[model samples]
Target chain A: MAYMKDDQRKKLAVDVTRNSKGATKYILITISVLFVFFMLILPLFSVIVNSLKEGLGFYLEAISTEYVLAALGVTILATVITVIVNTFFGIVASWALTKFTFKGKQFIATLIDIPFSISPVIAGLAYIMTFGRSGWAKPVVDWINDMLGTDIKIVFAIPGVVLATIFVTFPFISRELIPVLNAQGTDEEEAAALMGAKGWTIFKRITFPHIKWALVYGVILCTARALGEFGAVNALSKTRGETFTLPLEIDALYLAGSADSITASFAVSSILVIIAVIVLILRNIFEHKSKANREV
Target chain B: MAKARKFRGGRVIPGFGLTFGITIAMLSILILIPLASVLFQSFRLSPSEFWGIISMPNVKHAFATSIGCAFIAAVINSIFGIMLAWVLVRYEFPCKRIMDGVIELPFCLPTAVAGITLSKMYSTKGEIGGPLFDWFGLRISYTHVGLVIALIFIGIPFVVRAIQPVLEKLDSQYEEAAYILGASRRKTFFKVIIPELRPALLTGFGLAFARGIGEYGSVIYISGNNEKEHTQVVSYIIMQKLNYLEYESATAIALIMLIISFILLLFINIIQIRQSRRTNNI
Candidate 1:
């Protein structure tokens, strides 16, 4: 206690009053850390704790083995299909928007933001109302079922999940790519064409490289989003034993009131967090590289 | 710039043809079609009935709760975002990089995870929510308060990211000039610094507001939706309709929100444009 001299105490009081940047900075940093602790770190604590108990063995013994795996498979399948679909759509849309202008160019740019504004639950319901049991696509689905005889379904199944995820995630690739492409310009494309390099050749040699890193970053984000997709998937699919993603699995486990079953959900989330961290690090690298390039 | 290479009809550029054609098709199918479908479905009800459906106390409550909570959250963000950004820009501090990363958490963490985590923290037995409730009997879980906190969590980053760039872009000369004239730091900030930031601040506020209006996942767990009372939000109302097989009602609700969002965004744009013009005149 004596180590805190009267002079030192007076200096501390003076520092607080005059607003020493260091002391205030410490308070600000602490507040920020508290924010992160509340927001990012805490939720992760629960997930990590749960995941610890969920060995690959817990999954095998607890439930219907085939059903669980199929659910797992369906989740991956949906993520893959959605990523491919959205990436292609986003790329083409961005590429097209950059390379051309027409009567409604501004209108179309606004339209591209539709997915961002849309709630996933609404998006899911949109698909269902359009193509679910009492939908416009019902007859088409029925005809296919009749032709194929009973083993096929679209709504409330993997196909529906894929389509819904694709719809909800469309803006990712286009939003990232359009800006990069717009900045890149059409000079090279024109130059390549003048040299008779052809459309595909021009894209491969020039356009692709310019946008490749951003494309990867965007696609990774899109994929992570797809993996953790919940609201839309929840709306579309029922019968958790039949169709469930990792988040849905967690939802079901929580609702079923088994603390132990929650383990599977946590394990899946931990896996996703790991994947996301890797993707985010890559994104950060590309972003910093682009900034550096701009400075140059 | 060549008229010959412009590919006819006074088009801006040659590739415009292909781009326009593709963009229009994509927009029509993917964007316009779904939104239009929502409107078309909403029209399934008669005029008076549509009003009744939309103006139900439950629906109105949901709508109001969502708007009110979101507004509160956005206001908090506006204040905090500005302060946090100022701190980040103006000072050198320990673990400053970590502070930078923390702002982006609302962006990176999955919304579902956010919902679950926040609900646990604010429940009757958890850390902060529990302590506050124990002290004052002011519960956060399953209440309007919980809804706002959830929203504030998700909406903070939108404003912070938006304003951080603008703050960095401003010239510090005005602040110095004000200081030389003997203005207080507070007066200098309000006079010199804030006027420059108004347009950017408003734009960030608009984005955060728009984002809050559409937020669903984080709100749902904490909101404790009873359908007829305080907790239900517009997005959940849409979900409930989908659950009830009332497709028209669902679409109507979503369409209404979409229109409101459009108007808010348009208003923000107009203000920004006029402000920019005024500043240029100055």
Candidate 2:
């Protein structure tokens, strides 16, 4: 009778602990979900809501304005060019870093990550000092313009916008590619070389297949970053309607301080929000694909 | 001959010369040379001149506001980030995948968009701000409180992403052992689990802190940008200097920021390397 009573007591203790554990889990989940909602989801929701508050026609008209269109064009142009340049750099840098045994390799890798730590505003300022009038490179820039018989302004121009974008997005592709390539090793390439296969052939057949998904993943991230680049581009691009990217245009419209312009700012913001959502979805898909490839 | 041997050490694959040349050339033109200009520009000023610019009261106040707020934001992020990572890793909730995916929103979403939306939502007549003002009479937008909130938003992903993988790979055996040894649940979490998570947590805190210090776009809108001592951040000061065409002063401030960030990153890198080494040894 006493033994039975002790067993019952132990059973009750276990049940109590388990119930408390369950409560703790529920509480954690609730708090975490609420945090995400308030900090992230709700603000995104408000953007869309306020955007259409003046109705869809106004939203459409707001986004289709002449400056908005020009900003959109500039943004897309910068993103495309940045993507192309960074992709080429990514492939080469990752290949060199991973496939070869070289001194200062780690140093070089650290150097690539410099842009991530540096403020984008500083990045813009750096370019201005590098190429602006009275800069060290001014004579070189001027000579290039004179030799080509053309006016080519770098700072406060489209070239400056593209350069700033490139600076900020420099490491995304290579950072993604390096690890994937490192894990792949160079055994297959070595074997192919012994069999007298050319370098291009080896890469196309062996290495390319391994890194293709990661490359695309990197490119997507770079494109998203380039599209949204604000600070660096803000520093370099001066003429508002002529050189403004989407983010800058949104800033201008918001600061214009008219109620109509504020509403228009939200409308412009919705376009970026939509692009960001699409980028998020694509990022999720590619992230899974890359992880699955690594496991395979 | 020594160089040749070094090159031959891992030369099984071809195209080393071509690829390496391309890497160096592009890196110089794209990154290194441009950044060097900042250093060179700062050097144009005498040491006293550089000190005069950065040591101004307004400049010092901006740095203090930036660093102080970033530190607070990093602490908040560390606590909540660990919680979020824990919940995502250990719990099986509905829409969990979507929830996990949404954590990266701050990363991909344009900061200017985040800035405008956050500013609108936190303004006096805004949805969240309106309710709080009606009840507690608290104001958020254009205050120091609003600036920290913006920094927190910019920093959320860094901490969460850092902790997630570490939490995922943590072995359960240690926790089980702690429990068997009569340690309570909370005891096990703090003693056994937290020590294991320390490196990742520190890494996340460092990264978020660094990012918050230099944040510009998201902060400029919400921070009101009017109150110099209370709201102006370091990056805004750099912009202000540039607007005045004071390139030397701008570069001086930027160089300092660059140095601070590099140190933070270097510290994080060391922690990561040590963690990896320990994991490999195990």
Candidate achieving the largest TM-score: 2
lDDT (10s digit) by residue, model 1, range B1-282: 334555655533235456556656766765566566666666777888788788988889888888888889889888878877877766556766656655765665666666766775788865667898899888887888888888888888777877787676555556656766887667877888888888877877877777777787777888888764578888888888888878778877877887877776676656655765775585
> How much DockQ does model 2 earn?
0.55
Off by over 4 Å in 1: A1-27, A50-68, A140-152, A194-196, A261-268, B1-15, B179-181, B227-229, B265-282
Model 2, position B159, has a per-residue lDDT of 96
Q: What is the lDDT of residue A153 in candidate 1?
A: 70
How much is B148 displaced in model 2, in angstroms?
1.1
Q: After superposition, how far is residue A290 of candidate 2 from its true place, in Å?
A: 1.2
- Candidate 2 lDDT at A175 equals 92
Model 2's CAPRI class is medium
Query: lDDT scores for all predictions?
Result: 0.71, 0.89
Residue pairs clashing in model 1 are A100-B16
Number of the top DockQ candidate? 2
C-alpha positional error of residue A238 in candidate 1 after TM-score superposition, expressed in Å: 1.2
